[model samples]
Target: MKIWVLRHGQAAAQAATDAERPLTAAGQQEVRLMASLLQGQPLDAILASPYLRAQQTAALVCTELGYERGVATAPWLTPDDDPCEVLRYLAERQERNLLLVSHQPLVSQLLSMLCEGHRGAHVPMPTAALACVDTDFVAAGLGSLVLHRTPADLSA
Candidate 1:
């Protein structure tokens, strides 16, 4: 299975609540570029953190890929959630392709956990950055990174 994890675009920090935070104009453009880069991929499922930023970013990708607007909100992708559970869940699903839109630290942590079985071993995931991991079900240390991209890289 191949899993694509995308960090949410830049969002304002001073929002009344984290859930209410929205993406900035540049963030929107970043999403567009990221979406364009992923337009040709055949994503079997779309998952996202329930936060506004992640939801917004997922929406852009879905729009570009002609997927439905709704995304499955996985609590494990949330900022405060543990990534190992999510990894285990995905590993068991055996889906061919899955897209997950989430926040930093968590995205990076998840990648590290899958590839290295440890957290904080990889660089932090920047806004709108993506990491593609390929692995087999019920296997540990089987993940290999296929791609790691940022919005800026896509724009360039």
Candidate 2:
């Protein structure tokens, strides 16, 4: 199975609430570039944070890919949520391809937890960056990082 983890692109510096934050114009372009770069990747499903920025990012990705369905929103993918919950949930799914659009710490921590045994590993996930993990299981250290790219990397 391959899990594609994506971080929402740059967002407004301030909002009424953290979840209310929206993506900037550059952020939309970043996500569009990222989506274009990922056109060849197989995606069976997309799960994303409910935050406005993440939702926007996922929407753009879904639109680009012509997924034709609303992306699933998982509360457990919130920035402050636990990665284990997502792992547990993923363990039951049969889909070989999945995409997760989320925030900063959550995305990085989940990558570390899957590629390393813990969340202490340094995995840089700048805005609109993506990390692809290939593994048979969802356990820590069982996966290999197949690809890690950013909008800047793809844009170039």
TM-score of each: 0.92, 0.96
Report model 1's TM-score to 2 decimal places.
0.92
Residue 146, model 1: lDDT of 88
lDDT of 1 by residue, 1-156 (tens): 888989988898869898779999888888887777677787888999889889899888888778974688877788867777776778667569899998877888888877777776775578988888887753446688888988777667
Clashes (N, CA, C under 3 Å) per candidate: 0, 0
Model 2: number of backbone collisions: 0
Worst 10 residues of 2 by lDDT: 36-45
Model 2 scores a TM of 0.96
- Candidate 2 segments whose C-alpha is farther than 4 A from its true place: none
Best by lDDT: 2
CA-RMSD of model 1: 1.6
lDDT of 2 by residue, 1-156 (tens): 999999998999999999999999999999998898679777889999999999999999988888776799988889988877778888888889999999878888899988997888889999999899999988877889999999878767
Each prediction's whole-model lDDT (CA) = 0.81, 0.90
lDDT of 1 at 113: 78
